[model samples]
Target chain A: MAPTILILALGCAYNEELPEKDILGTVIVPAAAATRLQADGTTATDPRFIGPIFLGAYSGIDTVSFGYPHPSMGPIVTADTPGDAFPYGGTTVGRYDFACYESLACKVVTGRFSDYNDMLEYFGTVLGSPIQDDNGADVANGSTFQQACYDYFYATSDQEMAFLGDLDFALNADGDFEAAFVMPHTVFVEGMTIWGWMDAPEIVPANPTESGGFSSCDVSTGREFDQYDENFREGRVYFDALNTPSQYIYAGDWVASGAEEAVVNSPDDKPVVRLDFGFGVGEAE
Target chain B: MRTHGNLALGALLALSGLASGCTNVRDGFRPVLTDAPFVYDIGELRVIGAEELAGVDPSTVPDAVHYGQLGAGENAGLYGGATFQFRATGSSVCVVVDPEAMFWNKEISTQSNTVQYKFEDIFEDDGDLDLSAGLAAYYTGSPGSEIGDFSAVYDDPAGVEHELAFNECIQTGYFGDPAHAGRATVEYCDIDTSLHSGVMYTAVLETFALPIDDSILNFGALAFDGRCADLPWYDSNGALLAGASECVIPNEVEYADANGIPEEKAWFPELERAYCSGVGKVNTFCKDNPGAGCQSEEEL
Candidate 1:
């Protein structure tokens, strides 16, 4: 039998028994030691790799032209890499994780961090923040000029703080990240563990300035190509496939390299896709 | 606090009107009334520091008007230009020429490192006192964001869009006034739970003259051959009222902190109402009723 896959949610209380509002949920399935019935009713053995199975979907994705500057990876993409623009067709482009697909509906694991700061720092590291822009300038210069700029940009008379706090509360507490991840339904890992988790794919374009014929390109900085195209983003399906019993999938990508044959290896492989169906914002699930 | 300062600034502006008529005599300068009834053609204004707009549809705008970048700001993108026309249809009534077409641009970045910002081209950054009051009100209230869909409320000719749903009316009030002078403001929004961050309260008043004869209402606009340039939005009180405004125009940003939660509908009303009336017009009905134009503190 497949190891029972459980879906866990993050960012809320577990005891209150509230409807999962965060819009993100996780599931656990059979690992190397088990097998789950696929949609086709065939049972397949779990595949093992150095990193989590979730990361396999986002491997080798690029990050430049997605908004923030691309991180430094040897022989990969970066901002101002002598390219016209990222082929995604926007001033900014990048990838992020959306973990609420129907495929992630097996066993669940759950965990929580101490506070918002811990979550932000951990998420930033995992999502890749403090990355140098094309000019090698990160946001944390802490220079007098930068501080002065920040001061003027955020003038004293403006009500920017209140509005911002409202946004933070919405994204953190009311956004419902917790309910989907708590208990046996989800898995809880330390913030450091998430930061140290394997990276997402780096998706580069065959051409830099122009659209690369394909609907999207997944960037390795863990930034998927869906954000640029409205249609692709709407159609995104995020799934977590568990291989090892105690493992969580962090990053993966659709690859032209040997991944296709690997995905179709077994008769019982039920591929999972995690879909973030716009929680409390747009297009609700 | 903003009220007293605004009153003082209003008095100063009234004084400037005495000497404004005699200065900068132009051939086109006709005898303009204290409250001139004329259609102010809103020129092309651009959004600053924006590279892309998420939800705004460019094709929604009609092709009759020629859109230009107003030659200002850095990398403002296609969603940059906003044009609005305000005409005094009656004695003191300024109805938006095209209410449906009236649009403002807003940008909000969830990343703390990248502070979200929106800018309106309303002449000088802080040349006249009215400009400052007008700008502060705009940022704090009018522009609203539904999750990532940032929109500027076009109800007021001088207002900026605010993302807060609960206190939308408060924003309309704070930035609704077009009379105060000499202020330009930018907001660095800290996403903290406190109403007052480490930085709080900014007040400045620079007086400018408005003639009582046939001419533009604002002297600064007259100097530039009629244009206010880029204006800002929001102020201290207005920010508090965003929760109040959200009662009417519900947005995704407002739903983040759902109702019944301690943080829901929480705000300073004294500041909200006082600031709304002092700066903005007297709501939808007051503008409809001629005698009800300006409301005193007690009457409101």
Candidate 2:
């Protein structure tokens, strides 16, 4: 007969339960850059890194152009390379995991991201600070630059700690990633091992010149495609893994990478981190 | 705290208005306040770096009345162009336009580390702002992704066929991606056309499609010459283009967030009545009036 092991209940409890009003919220990172309480590899989704990745709470969806050199930004078939533009009639020329459709079931749709003021508001509200921010305010101005979140995924105005890098939160149907969800703080993955923890921001800039067909205009690094050096970045590194040699899927600038989350140690083990969906502001769920 | 900064910027823009009228407003340039809505088409603006656009003047750019292909998307492929009709009867000027793809999924990648990246764009090896400090200055928006079919049907001026959906309002969302600038209301839209008395003026639309992903396109159009380029349907004389300046139009506008249902009758307060609505997306208007313009269950 198999032996039964019954353990005592967890003695720890969260400081406070997040309120439901913080619906504008979504979990950025389940836990800080560490293993969940489930230890390593003891659960179903560890080691290999199976994730129900959290794509922070956003109001809409969009698709920006690819970043090939100016010469290749125009109509084409498929994106032969990362720096080149994709063809106009390619069979699957798209990015972004839209959890919603026109049926009005989910909250997703077409939109743009060029409004400077709107971007600032997004970085402030959606990408709340969890790291460290003295100002505790949104840092989106072109001049007054500041980190918005901490390693744990909460709002912050200061950069007290060093930022980490991970793979971009993306996936497709095969990996059960096509259907995305805005996870609240209730998602507890404290001790579980996290494979692709994000330590940096994923700032995928567009091609530097119009010669490539499309131009990033403002989000560009000013460096021409001829001068594009993968080893060295012209701007801040958002997605750390992307800066280095990696096998992520991308046509022009749209990247779709698969990232997963580790399951819990046992059904009883609660998340070591508190459920702070809204960071320090907004109503917490 | 951010509100104060916005107010400061607003004040600064207001002051700039006093000096030659080059002040940039969040919604638009200080309202020209002409007899008819000043129409302008940003479609002709080249897709160049910020440095390239630095010396550009709004008036110098293209408008719906007269615009060039601008070489980049001149050929009708991914960066193809579309045309809209601006028919005005009496005092009503109705310009028909469409919105394109919101999000794009990149195609499967091939192993090609052979090509290298240019270090001259934003920063260099060590990390220093280059001559083009604000190269991305013109890059103000972000991308939006949806799980469903966010497709549209686009018919260009030359009888060409394309797919697109009408969208201009940035609805409040529950999830977000830093890569996105929030759902694009429209690419730096403007109205530069002038309205005349009894003389019928047509604010022709020049729409363009740029492939931002493997296949998905960024379908968008802009009206120039200053003619109320605000909602999907509107009348320069404030009588709603087709019927009235109804906040909710058909097949033209779409709100992303379902939870953000319309509270009142579309964005009536923002548009028509107040007419604060402009080229960008206004989800607040769609709230409570999702079916404001729907004729029957078949229309929805």
Candidate 3:
């Protein structure tokens, strides 16, 4: 089927078994609450934290919770550079490298932003696109879409944000932030159909380097036919286009309804989204 | 005089029944079962070469394929899940056995080569009840007999104006386009073995890129005016596309239908509202179901 639009959501919540990590260092837990103004004309109280990623009503794939196998990294990190500090450093330096390792935990979860909009803004940064509103305004400052996503994320988080040591939502809520990267449904369809025709014209943050070199990755391409067909017609090629598209950038899996019943899951608990595609092998008339 | 009148009335009734074949199974319902293996003739066949195959691992062949059936945005895809057991003949069109059909009815032929079918047959496996049924549950009469008689009208993007009509029954055209109107007819199966009789019926799916009349708008109005209050703008991909519209429609008059409105509600305001209100709300629920909006209830 002409890859009809699919919905993939990434939950950005922290867990005990799996803590948020990056090139800089493992996430530092939070210590205190950061107060903010509430809509009820009163100050809002939060036991500030940032561990899990808050996911909207979409599903996750091509990531850990989605059953993707992790790649192994040989003894590379000595007692030196902490994993959290690597993502922000230069790849050529003695920083974290994405070249040697095929799969790393850093790509799974990152620090949490105060609200979900911060998460989307982070996505804009990673995708190298500027956020824009319907009226064509630069949405970086703040917009209805941004605020609504934040409110919805807070509400769905059960009013409790995740935190590690000092690198928690309470402390790092300022500026733009990101959660764990998840495969977005939009990217999958577009990537499959248009061959990355939608990748926006922007520069993604460069990878940090270390003595081990950029974390190893396996990226190759080839073709094959589906022997399942009577004459081995042609094999299907599947790509993970989630959270990665070129044009008309946006983020989160939440639908507009905002109905309380629509909240299916949180970031810690990844969602499952199925693609309904069936084949009818029947007569030809 | 009374006896003579009764005899004449009986004769009239019998004559009418014969003319329409109301009782003959072969002639009345399964007329296509005759010598003609193929029911609908191929009017216009255009294949959209695969430009880009996104996300598909070049190794695994797809179970189905959807080429550009209509306009730039118009498309079609084949669907028959794990239940798909038939093999593709490897022709421009493929053939397979209908497991769902066989499950419901055992008397029908199961030999893959026994019958000739096409993409239209996939709809029979219980997809969308309203859209998939075509004229079977709605309009009456033989679609094939009237195929050439039906007019094809195309509507523009605004969807209110009718651009032109094609005299021939084109199998494919830009769906909802102002310049095209005609139904694509394909055959499907309800497997019948010794245990049951399948629901064998021919269905026709009509498409138009834009609305031919105001009837289309009244069917599923999104109230783009912004006052959708809790409602959000989900992209065609089901991701939150835009935030709640800051521009709420001042009145129902300001409401115009967007694309993808249900056809049953395309006319008659009361029917349209009753049908669409339920659908619009359900769409929201389906969106929450994780890709459920893009599929049928059974698929979910």
Candidate 4:
């Protein structure tokens, strides 16, 4: 006779091998911008108001609203705001030490645009599907407009169109300025947009189209987009582990084409996405 | 059988706990090491003669060393003038001499100096280890003692070529130690050259010394130049000796051929080993057993 017995062990183990949640990168600004320029040029020696750059990343099918005239979609991270909220219980802000930048502190404002809907409502645009207004008439979405926009722009179905966390800039060991963004690995698909706003105003501007001539997220009557060249810089890149090298891109190139689609489609881990800014000190032409 | 199984499980759990608790988890992780060395490019080498020393208060010129009672303007000499590069590693300092440069004098052809340059022993620890304690110990020990010697040939204003030997060179500069922030001046005494003329010609030259700023520590190029080996070797009794025959490590081609390692991979370590053996004091094992692998005796 043979004794028959079965044993089963059921216990939860801590997942030490969790996928990295942040895309890390370095940001190198001009020496002049790093030194004296304040957020508003009030205290700057150069009076350029180009100090304390604001950086953000958007997960949409299109790159249209990533820059200025869309201040309602506030910056998710800035030097002042730490522990700001983001998706999946993550902080909207990343790590930054003022000392690394040769400054005792930095002054910048965090935008209110934390997710996709806030961006769409502010821009009054949609992505794949058209939503009916109170009159049952179809509203203008990204697809119908035939304008340059990404598919993930206004879709709420999946995690595709989500605001990636904001990042704070700091100087690395190599003496280069850098910033890192923490977002779900799912947001790194093709058509991701990374944007930076140098010398961003402390107050986000009002959107004229909204009821009361102002959007809910508007903080004040903002400066005109044409007034400052620091208004917009956008790039389309799929940042994953394999493509995770510090990228040197110019801030003046408003529509910079980054990594190729084929490379972006390939499977890889989500590592730090290094972004170096080539914007030197001067007025925008 | 059940009791035995429980006992085994308990022992396993205990062992696991002990292993996890006792071992340093941080040691298991690899630390980020910087490759660039702390480069102190001499912006200007201000050489003041003994006569200039007369007008200035001795207290004001803390680095002023009296070499010889040489005449004023005639005594000031420049060897490897401005842009002279001083590359500091954790353990040794290499005064790079560009032979093609005008001040170095092409006629001398880069003669080797017999003085070995080293930081206080505390810097030799692993790059990942904190060096604050070592820096504290060094600054506290003898802040003004001569760390090494320097030698070069310079023609005086009279066009007479004379070998400039700084036997008592005191390194003074703000190493930017957290405790000490002001300048720690470095004064090199031309003792050897002064002895010949019976005139102590101390040319007090100012240098932007080591650990340029406070935030950086143990930062510099890992590879020691072959010219660094030109520092004179010393016997066990501190007697000045001639150049060691083993000082010449095999070139990349020779090293590759003998060990079957590719020259590309073998070159850097071989070059460093050659420097260590040439200097004698940095790595004694490399000096004693040149044929062995690049591991220092301390490492073995």
Candidate 5:
């Protein structure tokens, strides 16, 4: 009834439109080999080759414990942008856009990450969660409960150094650097769950990128599980929780004992690793 | 008299095990190779929810039964039933079917509503030497009559300790299969369900998550290596769950028992499918319940 109120109401009813179009791009890397060929022509010898970059929107779903399909965070996406065909590392999984919301909506969806960049970023986030519980780490697989690391990801910081693409295990018979073979696996970052493969550089390399990612990933001198046992045992080895809760994080998937064994997949190909994962990312030596 | 009795028992078992065999995973043992896709074994089953499903409520039962008994990390949706997976860790739980319980040999009376049946009449005894007491296959008298009476303890993220007790008889058998020993799968099926999961999922991530033709239900089974005779069924006691039976030479995979019966290894057959009273109730919810919209397994 008031003129100011009526004018405000009329203004509120106005709608704005913007022109937008969906963009498409493809990463070409045919000829399946140990080395992942990227569309940028830069071979992804690291685990980041597996795409589906997950940008964390929230801290985590605060459930008392972590279970399958752990509570979802908001605005999650498996693609680089909405509806773009992301590059796939393993070649077995396809591309898709995933938006899982913890509130009112949660999906136990499964897919492989198409790029390694997203995965490295994710690892950085996990290595950085304050107050991670012990059971929150890999349990049921026979590793005892440790107090400091709490979970498997941080407990084995030195070993995960390889997962970050710092260590290179894939090699040829001649002892030359072979292309790194990666396997997509299900990982839990705080509450959001995604299917990403673990990859670490077998060789120590000069660090690069915004935060330069992780240093443990560089194992150029060759790695021996024996060396990292104490580091992993002591939880304080790899990731640092010294950062803020938002920056802190822990993440990784269980190495498949059998093809059908890993919650990741059930394939007839009964290998030491489940079909969802691959061999050289560094299995329990 | 006791010495003579023991000697006689030994002689019988010697004659009983005249032959031994091996299992060929390719020939038949693979659960998927079966004609019907009953996700789990039907014989050694435990009926979980009494009509109200009050026993399995996560709120009341803080202790959780693991889902990877069959498949690892993943929940292999059984044909008889699917899973109740949590959105959090992908952890899942399924209907708690008693491993010792079997089907009713003879037709029993059905209550008019059909949804709820008298538990007493539903279970019948298998004609095995061990299952003697009339209706012996099932625990005496009531559902909780056979006191498995075991407790499982867990500590939460907050360092808060939690303990869960067995409501029914349960005994763990020694499975010679690799179990992938250090791995996390039950080497068979893991279908989980929960009240809070929001979705009643039935996807056999490791095996076959395909749909079946009709309604799905849980069944019992006697899963042995199929090499020796079936594991002698017994009431749930420390001896049974702990694999401490005379018929079961827990020490050796191949050995003879006191009864001259080769302590042949036995187990709940790989999880298969079966029809139970619960099917009716589940279907009722699927049909009337808008969210559940129960469909034939084929539709899953």
Candidate 6:
């Protein structure tokens, strides 16, 4: 009887060692950007405004362009439209008409195409002609048409692939603004890419001449791609399967390194990834 | 037989241990309250004007328009702003009113309005003068043609006069038109002698408006007890004046202590009113007294 009881106790203690299937990490922002005054007179340190930071894991799926309706459909495919126009058929496109469809497609296509001139040439060919936008202008196959399609798309595909999460920075015991996130273990599998942004004001000046104090990227005047690139230039850092030497990957240099080297293990064994804005050094204790 | 029994006992013990461990893991996931990054101690004053459908065409106004607390959600109230006049004696702190102090909502075009004020913003010294005690007079009036002379005067024990300005008024372009003009005044005060170490003082909020007799006439006042003190005026015989009941002062200390919760706290007066009206969350005050007016929560 004594031996049976001892065995039961040992089994319970050993079961506690089983690993949790989640990828744990911390996001660090420069003190200057976190403390900068927002338009509402409150800084990112305030919880109300701290939720702009987004993190998403991609399965390397081509969900943006190839997954939706064919480009020949002119950026808008409604439920009533013929199913043959879309590659995957009508049920997948939902009830999206021309007006609502253009905004989403433009944002996704803009994120996928990095170069401004290259996007102009590519969209100019694929987007059909005589597609009148909301302002009653012929936007097909023109630079003005391509500029209209620009906005923030977090992942490579629209399905959110493997995981999508948002981090909210709050004043910790040490009074520093910090956010933490946990991704699924499947995100570490091969052919998966992780990307995110702090959704904060531009840390570095966009114009070469202007200096001092951060400024928000103006999207209304057809500067969506510039704003997207500015967000990446502010800071980029990620943890892959390979445990590569963690460092900042600025705008033009960022590439989605597939998680071929990721090691599936407990959160305790993984190192924390820091996303730092150029203003100051951020550390995770 | 003995060997077989020992092997069976070991297996059973291991299974029991593993089951217990799984329970412990699930228990760890239970949520517990954490410290909030910021805390706000808020006090809300809801002023609902009575139905005023005299001069204007009643057919043009919607049923919901007459109610002071408009909109859908819990934060909805009279959509205008008020000027809180704070007068203190026994202290030389100059009370400066920020021009942008009024919280106005132009959506509702009625005389009803709700004013939400934070205790820390008014009393706490953020490199400014710290206010102890006196009188907090809140003056709110309906839409008038031009800005009126809305002012208050406070006399301390030493006979030195301190004039506090309450010059905030809602102005409309149609002042000359009798159909759109009306007179509705909601005045209340809060006096807490125990909270601050200062001399007792009396203050008055006088509002002057254009004479437009045909507009809707409605006057409604609601004051929370313990937090509200009546503005008392006595004759030589030391008798309370006739209109003393019309004014109620807010006790700043008790107001803060009632609504200030260190971990995750927010108080909505609309929710309290709904609770008092036997519709929403069960309030203790409303529960104890069946028909108690949904005064703002004295202790949240």
Q: List the DockQ of the predictions in order.
A: 0.01, 0.01, 0.01, 0.01, 0.01, 0.00
For candidate 1, lDDT tens digit of each residue in A1-285? 233322243333357653221112222211321121222334333211111222221111223422221211222111222211111001101122221211111110112222224323322232233222223344333243233333534544323311111111011232221111111212211110100122222212222112111122122223222323211221221222211201222123111121222121222233222222111211110
1 or 2, greater by lDDT: 2
Model 4 chain A: weakest 10-residue lDDT segment is: A96-105
Model 4 lDDT tens row, A1-285: 122222222124445445333444333333333333222323332211223332343332122433321111222211222211111112223221111000111221232233334333432321111233324354444333212123213433323322222324555666544444443343343333333333321211232222111011122222222223323112211222011111212233112122222112222433332223333323321
Query: Which portions of model 4 miss their true places by more than 4 Å?
Result: A1-169, A172-175, A184-281, B1-300
| CAPRI level of candidate 3 | incorrect
* Candidate 6 displacement at residue A54 in angstroms: 8.9
Tell me the whole-model lDDT of each prediction, alpha carbons only.
0.21, 0.23, 0.22, 0.26, 0.23, 0.26
Model 1 is docked with a DockQ of: 0.01
Candidate by candidate, in order, the iRMS in Å equals 21.4, 18.2, 26.9, 30.7, 14.6, 33.4
Worst lDDT run of 10 residues, candidate 1 chain B, spans: B93-102
lDDT for B169 (candidate 1): 12
Alpha-carbon RMSD to native, per candidate: 26.4, 27.8, 28.7, 25.6, 27.7, 29.4
Error of 3 at B86 (Å): 17
Candidate 5 local lDDT, B1-300, one digit each (tens) = 001224455445445554444333332312333232322321222222222222233222112222211211121221122122222112232222122212222224454433432122111111111110111121112221111112345333323334532212122337433221111111222222222233322111112221121111121211122111222222223222212122121111111112221221131111001112223433343334322222333443
Fraction of native Cα contacts kept in each candidate? Answer: 0.00, 0.00, 0.00, 0.00, 0.00, 0.00
Chain A fold similarity by TM-score, each prediction: 0.18, 0.18, 0.19, 0.29, 0.18, 0.28
Once fitted onto the true fold, the runs of candidate 3 whose alpha carbons sit more than 4 angstroms away are: A1-285, B1-27, B32-300
lDDT of 2 by residue, A135-230 (tens): 333344633332222322343533232221222333333332222222334223222211111211221122111111111111233222232232
State the lDDT at B232 in candidate 4: 40
Q: For model 5, how does the per-residue alpha-carbon lDDT over A194-228 read when each residue is reduced to its tens digit?
A: 12222221221222212212222212222221333
